[model samples]
Target: MANIIKKIKRKHKKKKLQAERAKMEQSRQNRTPEDAYQERLSKHRSAVIRRAVMTVVAVAAVATLFFFYMEKRSYHNYKILSASEQEDVVATNYAEMSGKILRYSPDGASLVSDTMDTYWSTLYEMQNPVADVRDDRAVIADQDGTLLEMFDKDGETGSVTTSYNIIKARVSSSGMVAAILDGGDATWINFYGSDGTLIAENQTHLADPGYPLDVAVSDSGDIMMVAYQFVDGSETTSYVAFYNFGDVGQSEDDRIVSGYTYDGVVIPQIMYLDGNRSAAIRDDGFTLYKGSQIPKEVETIKVDKEIVSTFYDDNIIGLVFKNGDKDKPYTMRGYSTDGSLKFEKKFNIPYTTIKASGGNILLYNSSQISVMNSRGVEKYSGTVDGTISDFIKTGWNRYLLVLDNGVDVIKLS
Candidate 1:
């Protein structure tokens, strides 16, 4: 009896499943053409979406692989995009300005584009010409001479005839010119507009506040920094003076906003890192100052090892020291304006110019060039066939190799 009942239950379950299947088939047969088309369209749409997703994933994977390959591959050659006429590197001093090259000589100066078009050019004469650039403005002065010429991105702005010989000269971003002039028993700091008009002049004697070692104007063309060195008693001391030409400094004596004095330490080099920051490069170490209205000392980094070379931009301050390590004898360090160390890289290249730009350290000599990223990873170390006066990074894997022969715009491959 139990076996018969189990067989009956199984037959009922099978009949129910068969009836549901027949009902579903009848529903499909009675359906409208629109319904059937909708069903097919839905399935087709899902299939198309899946294929699109798969293709996107494959393309992304390929792009990632290509990026890694390019990053890791060692570049040994370059492809020149354009070439300029051959200009002797000695006759022309080239400086990068707004993605173009400022080619200047004792005879003249011109700002030329990468496509071999001259933006502007002017003729001048000097026995010894020295150029100092700040932003788009540049001041080219004749050392031990009185001729001072100024330029901008457009063309020649002004020319000044100094009464005293110019020991050193600097230009601000807004086209303010400052010159250290030689006096008979003193030094004169003369400030001038880009229009060749004298704005102000201050004289310093060695027996007084001291001899101005170096002078730098702020990018805003409002502040001036002078590093003065003097001997008092048996110890030699230095003073880092900051003067403001803005309205905030009008009431103060000589427009003095802030100043610092150092005893027994010589600060021969001073510069305005930006509008709000300044640096006084001392013989032993370096000091950074900050402020717009009143300049004050923010940080000082002391160095035990002798600094071999130093370079900086608005964002980074770099120092290269002679390391004690025999294998890697050069230690390159980068710091922010707050005195925080960013990177410490070890290299052995006998570099001529060390430049920090866009978070990469670029070092190059006459033939060899090396590039290291912010993480101290050497991305490129290669050589060019010609004598390189300037190796400028134009873009990713691209450089402007300013050789003695011509300008070779190249891409790393």
Candidate 2:
């Protein structure tokens, strides 16, 4: 009985130990499979993540390259040729404090700045101030007298001293300077070159005391002087006398071709009338001179109101006429070369400042500068900082803007 009892106890202990070993083996099997699966899953996930990151980086690099390529293409497309290819640009700077003048080429646009004092041509402390600028020069007057100074990209040539105290100075695009000289026994008029060399001198032996108030020099090198009174003194005739510089101080055969007079009391706005040859404006009436000497062939355009601003190109002459008083609105009219009125439009927004280039027009009210084409289509306008005192066109679509603190040249895309 004791042996049987001991055997049974040993069998029960063996069974218990077998059960414990089986449970430990089962737990180890389960843990080892799970650990292997987890490690494999972690490696797979890392590979997937690395692939995704690389794909994203590659896409971003391609996009960046495409963006730079587009930018470079656009830049090349809108590039403008230098003025030496066609036309030249003349820039002017006024030093308000020192009362001096600075001039430079439009190509070297970076040169005009507060440091202009270091690069100006004539560095004299002016007493009065520069009254007007035209052609490639400025008319500076002081208590001593008035002098016409021509400036290039480098500096100024010697000034052309006029005997007549010029009430108004007008310069042609061809660089001809005309002023209202003193009317007396010794009073006369003359045109000077950019180097202050006398080109042509004209003295009028008028039966009456007649003085030329305004003058126009054409691109073909024809000088037209609009005198208020004629020698006969009957009708208040505006004399259009033409002079030639090719024959300086010569006889009648060497004189310039004199054309017929378009008579009126129209004060010659010399700068606007002279620069463009195909167009002419006399107050409310605008005419297109088609290079024909016949007076009847000239196209005459009549407007209902007085003219405010006039823009002339090779094809058309755009006139801004005041519709009503200053409190009322204004209208702009476009006229053709055949004296035909083409289009008339009204602007509710009065342009406080206006500038024209070729057929492109720019109007600045206060906050924005509106750009418009010759067809009266609004192109694109942009906002400016502070007050824009003045701005001028540089290249085909670039502008040199004068700000309060500094000057910036903006190129639009």
What local distance difference test score does each model get? 0.85, 0.53
Compose the digit string of candidate 2's lDDT tens values, residues 51-106.
99999999999999986664343221122221111212223343211122233332
The TM-score of candidate 1 is 0.80
The estimated TM-scores of all candidates read 0.80, 0.58
Using lDDT, give the best candidate's number: 1
Error of 2 at 238 (Å): 3.2
Clashes of 1: 0
lDDT of 1 at 411: 70
lDDT (Cα, 0-100) at 131 in candidate 2:
37
Root-mean-square deviation of Cα positions for candidate 2 versus the true structure, in angstroms: 21.0
User: How close to the true structure is residue 187 of candidate 2, measured as C-alpha lDDT?
Assistant: 46
Report the Cα lDDT for residue 120, model 2: 47
| Model 2 CA lDDT for position 372 | 63
Worst 10 residues of 2 by lDDT: 78-87
